[model samples]
Target: MNEELSARLRTAAEAHQPDRARILARLERGMSGAPDRHRESSGARPWPRVALASLAAAGILAGGGFAVAAIVQSPPARPDNSGTPAAPSAPSAPWTPPHTTPPAPTTGGPSAPDRSSSTSPSPEVSGGTVSARPDSAHVQDGPLWSAGSLDASSNTYWAQSDITLKTTQPLTALTVELRITQTGAVQSTGHWRTLPADDFTVTVQPEGAAVVYRWTLKPGRTVPAGQHVFAGQYNHAAGRREAKHDGYRVDATGPRGALSVWGGFTPAR
Candidate 1:
C-alpha cells in the first residue's frame, strides 16, 4: 500500500511542475510586450502632434500671404474704349452781368421864346403923348431926356429913370423900361470896352403904382429884379461900370392916350 501511494504522489508532482513552468514563461512574455506597446503609443502621439503643428503653420503662412496680396494690389478700373484718357471737364464759364444804358435827362416844361436875336418894336409919339406901337410903324414927335453921365471918374453907377406922364385920363398901368450895358476900361491904358452878356446883370424896380407881373425874359434864368447879377469880368485889370449906352424908355398907357419917354448917354470925353 505504501508503494502504491508513493507512485500516485509522484505523478501529481510532475504535472504540477510542468504547468507552473508554462505560466511563468507566459507572464514574462506579457511583461516584455507591455513596454514595447507603451513606446509605440508614445511615438505615435508625437507624430500626430507634429503633423498638427505643421498644418497650423502652413495655414498661418498661407493666410498671411493672402492678406499681403490683398493689401498690395489696387482695385481694378473700368475699361475705356478710347485709348486717350478722358479730357478733364472744362471749367464752368465765369458768370457775366448784362450791361444797361442810362436814361436821358428830363426838361422841366416848355421852353421860352428866344429874344436875344431881334430888337423890340419902337414907340409912337403924338403931341406930348407917346404910345407903344407894333413893329409896323414909327412916330417921332415928343421931347426926349437923358439921365446920369458916364466919364472916367464914374467907374460904376446905378442909373435910374423916373417919369411923370401928362395925359387926358388917369393911367391904370405904367411900365418903366431901362436899357443898360456894362462898360470897363483898363487902368493903365484907359481904353473903354463893352462886357459880354454873362458879365453884367440888370434888374427893374417900379415906383409910383405898379407891381411886377410876369417877366418877358426866360424863367429861372433871369436874376431877381433887385439883386446884383454879375457879368463875367472882361479885363482883369479894368474898372467896371453900369452904362446906359443904349438909352432907356418909359411907357404910360391909359384910356385917353399912351405916353412914352426915352433917354441915354455916350461916354463923356
Candidate 2:
C-alpha cells in the first residue's frame, strides 16, 4: 500500500507544473478583496489560508521530485549472500606427498658422480694412487708380510718412499736401505723408521752417485714382531719423477735362519 501511494505521488508531481506568477496574482487579488469563485463555492476560506496551502503543496511536490532524482541516481544495493558458504577453497592443495631424494642429473660424458645415487666419487686419489702392498721380490726371503710403495703425495719437487714390514717373529738384528736414483739435483731430505729412535741408527748419505737412506737396528735391540714402517723422503728437480731405478732392501735375523728382501719401487697407478 505504501509503495502504491509513493508511486502515485511521484506521478502527480511529474505531471503538474507549478506556476509562481499565476499563484502570486491570485493571492494579490484575493488580498485586495476580489472574490475567489472556488473559495465562495466551497465555504468561505481565507485568502491567506489558501495562499499558505498552495505554498505547502508546491514544497511537497519539490521534495518528492528531489527524492525521485536521488532514487534514480543512486546505485542499487547488493543482495546479502554472507549467509551462503564460500566454495570449498580449491580442495586445500592436494595432500602434499612426503619429500623423497631427487635423482642425480644425467650427462653426455660419464655422468658426474652423485653421492645420493651411488657412493661419493672415491675420495680423489691425492696426487695419484699408491699401492699399499709392496711389489714382492724373492731377492732374499725373510719372515714375510712386508710391502712398499711410493707415497701418493709425491709430486714434481718432492717424494716419500714407504716400506711396511710385518714380522712374525722377534728379530735380533735388522737392516733397511732405500736408494733414490741420482736424477736432477736428487738429495735425501730425511728418513724415519717405526722402531724406537734409540733402538736403531738412521742415516741418509750419497753412495756411488745415488742418495741412499738406511736404518739399522742397534746391537742387542730386539725388533718387535709387528707392523713397522721405514719411509724415506727426498727432494729432486721440479718435474714428475719416476722411481723405476729406485730400490729398497730389508735383512733380518731371528731364532730362524737370517733372511732378506729387496725390491724396486713401482710408479703409482
Candidate 3:
C-alpha cells in the first residue's frame, strides 16, 4: 500500500494531466496512509520513513518555486550599437594646451618713402621734395637763389637754414639767373636762366639779406611776378629767352650775407 501511495504521489508531481487539486489529493493520501499504520501499531509506525518522504516532497516544491523565481528575475539580452564592447566608463580625452606662438612684430617707423630706383621728379606741392641729397640745405648770407616769373599768380618756395657760401668773386657784370622746373624741380643742368631787369624786382633790406624778385604764379591773363627774360648767360647757359628761377636773394650789407632758397611751385595745367 505504501509503494502504491508513493507511486501515485510521483505520478501527480510529474504528470502533465494532473491539476493542482489532483496533486493536493495525492499528498493527502500519502499522509493519511502513514497515520493509519501508526494507529494499527499502537501509535508506533515507520515514523522515520514517513518523515523522509515528506522532506523529499517539500524539496521538490521548493525547487519549482526557485525555477519560477529565476525565470522572473532573468533579463533579455540586447544588441550593442557600438561594434566594440563598451568600457565600464569612457576615459576623458587627453588635455591639450592652446598654441603659444608669439605675435608678429609691429611695423611702424619714421623713414622717407621708398624711392631708391625712382627717376621721377619731386611733387610740386608743399612739404615735399625731389632727389635732394640732404633733407634740407642752408643758404649763404649772400644771394640765395634768383628766378624770373611774369605770370601774375602767387609762387611758392622752400628754404632751409644751412649750406650758403659767401661769394668771393667780385660783382663785375652782376647778372643773376634762376632756374626752376615747370613742375618746380631744381635741376642740375640748363634749368637756370638769367632774368631781364624789367621783369624782376630787387629789394635790399638794411636789417638782413635783400630779396630779389621771386617767381609768382597767376592766371592766364596775368604773368607771375618773377617771370621775365634776360639777354645774358646764367651759370654758363646759352643766350636768354623766357626764363624762370627757383628763387633769388641779394646779400645784406654784411660780407657773409647769404640766402636759403628752393623752388617748389608749379604752373597749373
TM agreement with the true structure for every prediction: 0.23, 0.48, 0.22
What tens digits encode model 2's per-residue C-alpha lDDT throughout 38-112? 335556667777767678657655776677665556586655687865555465667889999999766766855
Please give the range of 10 consecutive residues that has the lowest summed lDDT in model 2.
118-127
For candidate 3, the TM-score is 0.22
lDDT of 3 at 167: 39
lDDT of 1 by residue, 114-200 (tens): 868444355545344332222222222132122323443443422222222233344344343433333332121212112223422
Q: Tell me, by TM-score, which candidate is best.
A: 2
lDDT of each: 0.37, 0.70, 0.35
Highest lDDT, which number?
2
Give residue 86's lDDT in candidate 3 (0 to 100): 53
RMSD of 2: 15.9
Off by over 4 Å in 3: 1-50, 59-263, 266-269
Model 2: how far residue 263 lies from native, Å: 0.4
